[model samples]
Target chain A: MSTITLIGAGQMASALTFPLYENGHEVRLVGSPLDDQVIDRLREDNYHVNLLRTLHDGIHYYKESEKEAAIQGADLIVCGVSSFGVDWFADKILPILDESVPVISVTKGMLDYEDGTMQTYPEYWMSKLPEGSKQEIYAIGGPCTARDLADHDPSFVGYCGPKMETLHWIRSLFATDYYVISLTLDVVGLECAVALKNGYALGTALAIGMAEKAGDDGINHNNSEAALFQESVKEMLDLLKIVGGGVDNIMYAAGDLNVTVAAGRSRTVGLLLGKGLSIDEVMEQLKGQTLEAVVIATRTARAVKALAKAGKVKESDFPLLMHVNALLNEGATLNIPWTDFQKEM
Target chain B: MSTITLIGAGQMASALTFPLYENGHEVRLVGSPLDDQVIDRLREDNYHVNLLRTLHDGIHYYKESEKEAAIQGADLIVCGVSSFGVDWFADKILPILDESVPVISVTKGMLDYEDGTMQTYPEYWMSKLPEGSKQEIYAIGGPCTARDLADHDPSFVGYCGPKMETLHWIRSLFATDYYVISLTLDVVGLECAVALKNGYALGTALAIGMAEKAGDDGINHNNSEAALFQESVKEMLDLLKIVGGGVDNIMYAAGDLNVTVAAGRSRTVGLLLGKGLSIDEVMEQLKGQTLEAVVIATRTARAVKALAKAGKVKESDFPLLMHVNALLNEGATLNIPWTDFQKEM
Candidate 1:
């Protein structure tokens, strides 16, 4: 029975709060400038964030203003807010928190609002904290989805921190038979991993939609659709390297787990777009787009740009990353031709 | 029941034969020299092709030498041989046959060994006949694999002919509950459709492998692997367009079906390679490797070059095709950076 404080009432915040509560942990949920309806809904639903029809329990909801007070005695502080809210929460909550409280990030990516890998979301947030603050931040990622988890779908999620103990603690905090969790101490590796996965997810959705429209009336392969999917995986894996992920990690992404993951928010969002729904109107249709992978890809693309500029990343990965970034932001309409990349490959 | 004669007894031949047999059609099987053992095994086992405990019945197996006599009265003569054997069989068999015979080509591509297409395959094969002789050739394709069909794994298979009656006849003859067969008279479109699917598949395997090998650390997403897969799909769609595949087809290739399909094959091959197996060893280990997309990518690269020289394919597609060709033959290495691309997005 650990007390967990989650800062944010956004889609991700609700997602984390409900699950932690259901797992028998006491959770304090906080959101920035949080609306009364969201708070009312959280309280009425018992911290339940319903998606595909499952309810999660045990959350004590609060506004962001109450975070410091609410988190005072908490064993763990998790930030499940969007990338923009990291600084606001860190500034207000860190000063009042106990020094030893382990913090876990249920969010999927680094903030993309700036330049340099040093400017990534968590790194930027941690930089403002006291010197030893880096050890407190950890990230949880992988194929798990908010909608699915909200629906109580049996799923796999991964958490990575600098220390094995921190990771283990997080695993224990989030673990359940229905929600299988794994731990790793590769903090630097994990942040980008989730981000890349998100980007790939969004990009894949676009690519698949495009291929379905194209069919098998091409000059080369009999079914260009099959060729497109096959090649899309390969392209995603390559971009993974440029962004600082390992090949083994991509094996999982390009593997069934990530591929099988339902992109609920992205799918709905894309479908709305396909059906001629404007983004703003579609944004009003339901909750915000919580596909962390897309957000992460955008952020990591910035980080990779910083890495490349600093001479940390190789020059060769430039064009590939450029193509991916374009797709992540504008959708997958601008992938480079492999034939254009023979020498590089 | 319609009498169907299947030519060639390799993996594809065996795969194509079972579905027809399972549909309760009486199939007369003919094999190349290399397929003697395959024929004997099917005969000894009472004509069964087993894939992971799913058994399919195989009926009437024979050697290529016996095809002439066996196929004499067959209503539909379907050939599933490698692109290499089209000429040999056409010359030997088409001559002795009646002009009214309808032939269905299960091969998605032309034999580079002899120039062929929906136009050329029939034109060349029928040209040798007496001046007044006439024969109809139909081409069929879809995403279905024989191995999957043998195991009764439900999937879509398609057939196309020059005439509606011919297509309807083929579809009716081949359709079954387990196999969903669609018929079309867009023979030219169908020929290229199946052929282009290979490019997307091969490009996917190559790109994902590279990304995974380069930097996607056991994390699946925004890292290098996702980027690469994303990029590869974009590139494939671009190339598909340049090479004559419709833009609409790109979505299907990028979709879940294509992603799942490629992920399975790429992971299998990649895992084998990662486990220190040679490419040939990996190829040998999987029976489905025969239809492996890379073979078609390479073949298309060859065809692109040929078409470029003859001014048949688009000029823009030529350069990209040339580049892919180089990559396939050279086995080049890629070390792309993510930083530059992030800025572009």
Candidate 2:
């Protein structure tokens, strides 16, 4: 059995070990320096507190200090760290990784380059690797939640990168009957779509919140949500196209984003905001919570606005994105100018 | 004030009178031949028993026998009849309708032409009207529920027709601050999108039903629903393109369809079918209730299958459509072949 090194002990990383372990792979789950306590818990109990279950016996735990030992002879390396940690992980692991070993990223976010161009997580990671490195890099995205993956509920995800030939082996390494993986070479589209979803989810959550506050008894806000969903998708597709990604990737992006919003967090934040709570009040309500939507919304909006200023993207092309960005970053109100929305994308 | 004649006494028609009456238009809500009892109720109580609320006092009710008088001097005529009644209404009213009076259809469905062509309701109505009649036909579509409209909840709908100039007056005539309207020239796409939504809603309903039966407690089936939704939109876009409509129209179609599925009827039928009730059992359970999704799913599937045979459309292009059709017409089990779904679409 091949040994797979997963460099992160977060929820996604923990959830991912199930599929690899179930596929008869030896899993080395190395926790970040910040995850020493989690590593201790895993070593003692073989359980992930976040997942609320004991991991399979096939898993081996490693602390951040054991990085080189964990990566030295692994068949494949996977990075499941949060987007913010990609650069740090790259700096730590790239020098030690074998040039022959391929890397697959489960991280979804955008990176702003020094040149002011926005790069996806996979792109950013690949750029940080040693020059002339033959190792292929791929990104995984779609509606597969960490909890659902852990539960062995049927999950579908997209594997995307420039190296199409490498995906079959990657697919075989992780895919179970319940964990289905579809392949695409549209890496830019897939990564951008995944990163931008959190921002869009915030917009939809606001609509949900407004519907709840409107107090139409027994009438669900599905209509408003659907409208917001369509608009969000349109804006996403437009932004993707502007950033040199395929519009076709919208299918996967829309599906994944919809699922994410429906399952809470982003929507929960939006619901509170939509109920007429100010940003400060909502943040107080969600005190001590790491709201990914807020983080991504602020960052992606900044990146897009920068792109717009450089004439690489048009501001008018993305009214919803601008409104959402303003709402999150500039303390703008939750009033979405639905009338100014373009009918065609 | 402009005199407007709405020639259907159904829920949508009844709901629509609120806007017209509120806008100070002289509204003549004429019942079809089948709506004798509804007309009697409206005349007696000025309330739609189905809506559980009284209509504004300004509306003028007309019996089925008063069709000629209702249409004689109307500034505009709107048909809110169900799909099944479109042909019957066209036969009755086409001869009496003035050539100068524009018609707006709130009916959403398709008609099978004798030559094996499928025409949207607006097209079917326009085709049946007197040649050289010069009457502009438009369609109103979106996530507008009759109950919501009657309750004066904020609603947004699209007005689509070839006559761009006519939309201004149409918008002004119907749009309240709460009842918003957008305009498009893609009448074919709008009508087809609205009609086909029922069929797609059935597919999504089945997904929801299956998710509910799978019993993954606390895990919202939003992922499954989202996947199904994306597939539905792809099939819709493909079909719309094949039928000489814009794929851009997918925005409105997706929004309307999502809203429709989430808020009952179609989903109810799907849920029951998903719960292992045979088609016959579900029908028996509903008794004499009119299930629009069931009617549309059977018809749309038949139409698509016929198109597939004629090389007009590819059967492989629409797996969800084919599967739903099989489930409804062939008594097939609720087996969704998710793996076989096209990744790009």
Candidate 3:
């Protein structure tokens, strides 16, 4: 059993310690500078602050200052930072890394350009690394929730990177029966699919909000919800194809979208909006929350709007994303465009 | 306003009368030979037994003996029968239809031959029509539930047929602010996509059962359910391709699959089976209930097995369907083959 070092003490990072610990690996979890409190809590009583679970005391915990020590002699490193921490990790941690030891990221994000081109996290980091560096970065996708993984629930995910051999080796080391893995070489597809799901998840969950706004509690409004879901997936498919992704990558988008719409923080954001709450009201209510879904929604809209202006794509192609952007940024009311959804062929 | 006659009084058939009446058409509801009780109840109290809601009184109700009187329509006809009533309608109702009027089916079904080739109901009905006589058969698809439609909830459906003008004409007469319609010429794609949802809905619902069986009440098991849903969609994509259907036709399958997994009777079957109940126990418990899911599951399984023998498709391509088939017919328990779902690419 080789050592595995995780560079962020976030929920996903801490939760992942279970499978690694179960696999007889010497796992080291090092917190970023902002995660000092969580690191302290974890060190004090084997309790994770965000995951809210009592983890095995055997895991080695380290603060930001101890990151170098934690990274020493690691066979595999996990880039477990959130999108907000990407630049932080790149500036502070990438300079100290061994280029030969491969890293797989749990972070799901993308850099969207106005030209209808998007870059996955792996691409972003690979560009930032020293030129001709041998480091490899992979991205994870599909409907994996931190709590579910910690609970040992069966979860499916796509492990995507450039090298098939590296992906197979990572799958061999990381995958449990519960943490089932599907490998793909199309890292951009998996990353974009997962990132797109966050915002569209918020959009799809508007059905609950729509129902609540109408004061109809008994009906699930599944007909409308399913319609929104299909439209979200259709937009995701279109966006993925535009970004040079694969068709089979739809599984990553559709599955995770369902999970997020069902129980993620994205659903709560959508529920509040569906109740006719404005952007200011929602921001005040959910203050101190990350609100990545909102961030991604507005970001994607900006990119799509730019793409539309450049004649790369049509604005009508993303009614759901545009609507969500309006809801989150422009204080627009929650009125779904039912007519825009019905396709003609 | 034109007079439109519907040839069955099932929940789906009866539920569709709301849109027809709201569109200012004179709608006539006719019972098949077996729907005498429903017809009598509708005639006596203006109530539908299955839809469980009061409908508009303007709709004319007719018994099986009064079919020809009801069919004295001017513009169009709705073959609003369930799959079970398809043969009955073809044998009894088709003989008297005026060749000039177009017939749209709310019934979702298909005939699967042992040769891995499937015939959609529209194709089935057209072939059975007398030689040299013309009857244009169309189909409706998507995530439309009877209760939601009868409640005048916002719904989106695809109106599919051979002719664009005819589909457009029917859309003008049927679509409302709430009852939205999408028009497509891929009758086979839409039909197969919808018919495939029933059995897969059963497979997707196994997550709820597995969670219940494990006594894990706190978790929604969205991961497993979403995985099952995706697997169901993937298998559907493979089968739809094999059957000469279109790729964009997945919206019909995925959306309806979500609806069925959410509230349809298929969920109950999956739940019972997931809780480790045998098919005999489930049958005894749900006796007298018309389980079209069971029928379709076994039917598709037989056809697929034959197709596999002929080297048309691999059984591994449909682990979800094959597992459901075994659970229903082969006395197998509810252990899902998680390994089988992982894709290597």
Number of the top-ranking candidate, with lDDT as the measure: 3
lDDT of 2 by residue, A1-345 (tens): 899999989888898999899888889999987788888999987888766767887689999999888997899989888766877778887767887888888887786653346688777777777778787788888876787678766666788877777887888899876677778898998888877888788887787888889885755556567667767766777777767887667766676776777775787887887787877898899997668788777777777778777777767767777887777668888886766563421
Index of the highest-TM-score prediction: 3
Comparing candidate 1 with candidate 2, which one achieves the higher lDDT? 2
Give each prediction's DockQ, rounded to 2 decimals.
0.04, 0.40, 0.67
CAPRI level of candidate 2: acceptable
Ranking 1 against 2 by TM-score, winner: 2
Ranking by TM-score: 3, 2, 1
- Model 3: per-residue lDDT, tens digit, B1-345? 878888888888898888889889999998988899998899888888888888898899999899889988458889988788889878888888998899999988677776766788889889889999878988899888898888877787888998999999999888888888878998888888888888999998888788888884566577888888778877888777877888777777877887888888788899888888998999999998888788788778877888899987778878889999999999898889887888876
Models ranked on DockQ: 3, 2, 1
TM-score of 3: 0.97
Report i-RMS for every model.
14.2, 2.9, 1.4
TM-score of chain A considered alone, across all candidate predictions: 0.76, 0.94, 0.97
Clashing pairs in 2: none
Using lDDT as the measure, name the better of candidate 1 and candidate 3: 3
